[model samples]
Target: MVLTAPSPKIRRSATKVALVVGSVLNLINQGAAILGPADISWVHVALNFFVPFCVSSYSAARN
Candidate 1:
């Protein structure tokens, strides 16, 4: 099946949710690196937020 882009409202909502959830997840998953001198995995950090945003937007679009 083909997929279309989600609406602006859905994208905005998904972004809000992603930011909140992703921040919590990042803090939990990489607190040491974030709060210390250790190197942080930038890719992993982006995915953590992006995955949630995609999931939210997809679900909204499906509905």
Candidate 2:
């Protein structure tokens, strides 16, 4: 009998999906810019840092 592990390609695909979803969320946040104050743009910039930290931590905890 033999056992096999998941391949690197599968891991890379999952990472790509996460990045795409994160980018889409960022775009949605940016698209809301016109409705808020001048500083609202800062929120989108902040998410660049915030989102990855949050997602990484959450994923780490799940493992």
Candidate 3:
């Protein structure tokens, strides 16, 4: 099947989901770097948010 971009509304909803889920995950997975003396990996942080966003968007688009 051909893939297509999700609509703006779906994208917005996905983004919200990603923000909440990703933040919680980051807090759990990278709390030390976030709250203590450690170097934060920007790539990992971005992926944490991005993965959820993509999952949400894909699910919405599929239905």
Candidate 4:
């Protein structure tokens, strides 16, 4: 038996969606830093940004 790969359109759409979602998460984290509680720790906020995950997604899309 053999399986066929998804078409280019579908693959691009999926990657775009993944990138957008990752961007939204990063944006939300940044916005929280600007408008959220003053007592929030810098370390915690930095972690919330999820930079590594977003970067990995971007790299994947680029390839």
Candidate 5:
């Protein structure tokens, strides 16, 4: 069997894409809270920061 390694450029590009997507989702979640009912704001807050932080940390560690 042969093993292939990913190039550094590819790794960096993937990381950047992940970070951008996470950031966009985070922003959307936060924005949603502005128009949503007060009771649902907490949920948005949690999703906005918690999920992104977890994904970002994992991506950073991988790099």
Candidate 6:
């Protein structure tokens, strides 16, 4: 079996996802400082999960 490299599009998508996740986490941390952990909402949970899920799915499907 031959090993291949990921395509540019996939790389870009993954990087973008990483950036977005970082930014979101930063906001969450900031909010938590003021509001505490119990303030997490369903929308935040869904975005934290499904955003990464879709990015991973896109990369895997392309490969």
**Best candidate, TM-score-wise?**
3
> Could you say which candidate leads in lDDT?
3
Candidate 1, residue 50: how far the Cα is off, in Å: 0.3
Give the per-residue lDDT digits (tens) of candidate 3, residues 1-63.
025445787889999999999999899888999889998988998999999999988888877
- Put down candidate 4 lDDT per residue, 1-63, tens digits, no spaces: 012124454456555655666557556656665677645456745554445444544555555
Over the full model, what C-alpha lDDT does candidate 5 score relative to the true structure? 0.55
- Candidate order, TM-score descending: 3, 1, 6, 5, 2, 4
User: What are the per-residue Cα lDDT tens digits for candidate 5 across 1-63?
Assistant: 012124455446556765676568756755655566534456655565556555655555565
Weakest lDDT window of 10 consecutive positions for candidate 1:
1-10
Which residue pairs show collisions in model 1? none
- For candidate 2, the C-alpha RMSD (Å) to the true structure equals 7.5
lDDT of each: 0.86, 0.54, 0.87, 0.52, 0.55, 0.59
Which residue pairs in model 3 clash with each other? Answer: none
RMSD of 6: 6.6
Q: Which of the predicted structures, 3 or 4, would earn the higher lDDT when compared with the native?
A: 3
**What's the CA error at residue 33 for candidate 5, in Å?**
4.8
lDDT of 2 at 20: 72
**Cα error of candidate 4 at position 37, Å:** 16
Select the stronger candidate by TM-score from 3 and 6.
3
RMSD of 3: 1.8
Alpha-carbon lDDT of model 3 = 0.87
